[model samples]
Target chain A: AQSVTQPDIHITVSEGASLELRCNYSYGATPYLFWYVQSPGQGLQLLLKYFSGDTLVQGIKGFEAEFKRSQSSFNLRKPSVHWSDAAEYFCAVVVSAGKSTFGDGTTLTVKP
Target chain B: GAGVSQSPRYKVAKRGQDVALRCDPISGHVSLFWYQQALGQGPEFLTYFQNEAQLDKSGLPSDRFFAERPEGSVSTLKIQRTQQEDSAVYLCASSSGLAGGTHTSTDTQYFGPGTRLTVL
Candidate 1:
């Protein structure tokens, strides 16, 4: 079965600091990776996706993720995080056309 | 344009009761999906529908859970005789339904404000 794993349950970082969230996936075939951000009481918003082409995919809100095939990892990174960036981040992979598996998510807390 | 939308943003149901959640996908989306998210856990896939055709429902937890998209647009997820374990946020999403060819997966999926189901 295809699955996504996000190691960090929570992360605390000061405003303007760099942020990195780790994600590992297990799938038999090539995986279509995605990063989503969900603010408190809001729906999940797609930050970026990696289907093919460049391994490093840039997304909205200055987010970027690198798809490392050998390690089965797709880690999200932000050079500088804003205070408003504090939210839950989810890493997802599509097992099939409409079947997508998500990680437990990592809650980012930005210290002001 | 409007993104996905789900009705009854919050629902409180007693154990053994029935509950229904609604989802309206983005305009002209051919693929719809349903997911369940437990507290502090990521959303789990529940079912999938492509143009009124339910392609996969393997992710549904139990027989008590049912979903439908008769018009290939709006979708509904119904739970019968709900249990405490069924309490979670029910999310709905939609996509354009394009194939990923061989190894890759399909395109982006837009999500709605999930319906928080609380079984008491």
Candidate 2:
């Protein structure tokens, strides 16, 4: 079965440091990819998405993701992390219409 | 504009009980979806609805799970005789539909605050 994987279960980074969260998917064909963030007691919010064309896509909250077809990965990156950036980040893929499969998610903790 | 809203932000039920969770999608949204998110995990697709028609339900785990979107505005997910394994957060999402009630994979999905269901 097709699945999405996020290698890092938990990551701790100091405020103002650079951040990268990895995501990999196992699918026969290239599918629509997305990154979402969820704060405590909140729903999942779309941070960025990559459908086609440009490999690098920018999203809200100063976040960006690059889709690498060769590696089947779409990793999220931030030039500088903020204290409020500490939350759970999820990587999802849409292999079919109206359906999404998400990874286990990576929990980010910002240190002062 | 109001985002998707779900009722009963939290629910606790006995092992053999049944429960219904409601979701109110954004106005004029043509697509609706239901997902199950367990603790420490991402949301898993459960069902999909195109307007008043249920286009896909292959993600539902078992027969005990059922979802309905009547009038193309509000949706409800019902779990029958819930089990201990049924404890999870139920998420609802909506996306703008294309003309003729069709939607593609690229549409951004707006999610609602999930309803946490705990079965003891």
Candidate 3:
């Protein structure tokens, strides 16, 4: 069985500050990884995904994540976060037969 | 293109009552998925369907949960005898299945706004 762990439950960052959210997964082989964001009362929106190829994958809203096989991690990062970037973020791994396992999610609170 | 859409954006049911959530995937999409997301938690896989065939339903919590995609375009997730634990947002997503013989990394999925289910 595959599982995902997000170490942080909540994080606060000031505007214009760099941010990084940690994510780790346990899978037998290389699995499809994805990052999604959700605002209050809204459905999740895909931020980025890593299937194969370049370790660093860029996503919308000036976000990116690096797939580190050695670390079993796919951490999302941003050079500087905007106020509107605050939301709950999730990391997911696709298991066999197209089933997905999602992390507990990290709630980001942007401070002015 | 219009993204996936879910009906009855909010549903409130009493305990032991039955509820049905609907999902309308993107037109011509071959794959559809249903997920459950509790408050302050990420979404959990509940079921998956390819066309009109349900491929996987192992993630459903119990027998009270049932899902179907009769014609392959629209799907429904029905919960009989709802419980407090069943209170969560139900999300639906659709993808254009694997491209060629290989899966494309960009086989991106489009999601609906989700139906929030509250069991009282």
Candidate 4:
């Protein structure tokens, strides 16, 4: 069965520090990839997505992701993290139409 | 201008009871989806609808789960005889879309504030 994996369940980073959240997927072909952020008591918001083209994809809120076909990974990154950036980040893959499989999210805590 | 909305932001029902959750997609959206999110886990796909047609329901965990988009605008997910395992946040998402195959940047799913369902 195809699956999405986010190894780190919780990560704590100091404000203004660089951050990276890992994501890996097991699928037959290259699928559409996405990153979403969910704040406490809120629904998810799309941060970025990767359909095709350049491996490096920039998304909203100063976030970017790189899709590595060899590694089967699409890791989310931020040059400088802010306090507001503290939230649960989810990596998802759309293997087929109308189907999106999400990995267990990584909860980031930005410490002052 | 407005995003997707879901009704009854929170629900609590006793085990063996039935419950219905509602989702209102953004206007003009052609695709609707429902997902179940357990604590500390990402949302899992439950079912999907395009317009008024239910295109895929393969993700539904059991027969007790039922979902429908009656008018292509609003949808409902019903659980018969809710179990303790059903205690999770139910999420609804909508995208300006056409059935499938065409994968474009414009067809992005916007999610609504999920409804936290608790089974006692």
Give the per-prediction TM-score of chain B. 0.94, 0.94, 0.93, 0.95
Local distance difference test scores for all models: 0.92, 0.93, 0.90, 0.92
lDDT ranking, best first = 2, 4, 1, 3
Choose 2 or 3, whichever is better by lDDT. 2
Off by over 4 Å in 3: B98-106
Worst 10 residues of 1 chain B by lDDT: B97-106
Candidate 4 lDDT by residue in tens digits, B1-120:
789999899999999999999999999998999999999899999989989999989989999999998888999999999999999999999988777785522367899999999999
Q: Provide the lowest-lDDT 10-residue window in model 1 chain A.
A: A92-101
lDDT of 2 by residue, A40-97 (tens): 9898999999888999999999999999999999999999999999999999998777
Residues A1-112 of candidate 4 have per-residue lDDT tens digits of 6789999999999999999999999988777899999998888999999988999999999999999999999999999999999999999988777578899999999999
RMSD in order of candidates = 1.4, 1.6, 1.8, 1.2
Write the number of the candidate with greater lDDT, choosing between 1 and 3.
1
Q: Name every residue pair that clashes in candidate 3.
A: none
* Every model's DockQ: 0.63, 0.63, 0.51, 0.61
Which rank order by DockQ, best down to worst?
1, 2, 4, 3
Candidate 2's displacement at residue B21, Å, is 0.1
CAPRI class assigned to model 2: medium
**Candidate 4 local lDDT, residue A80:** 99
B1-120 per-residue lDDT for model 3 (tens digits): 688999899999999999999998999998888999888888899988889888889989999999999998999999999999999999999988842223533467778999999999
Candidate 1 lDDT over A1-112, as tens digits, reads 8889999999999999999999999997888899999998899999999988999999999999999999999999999999999999999998677588999999999999
**Complex DockQ, candidate 1:** 0.63
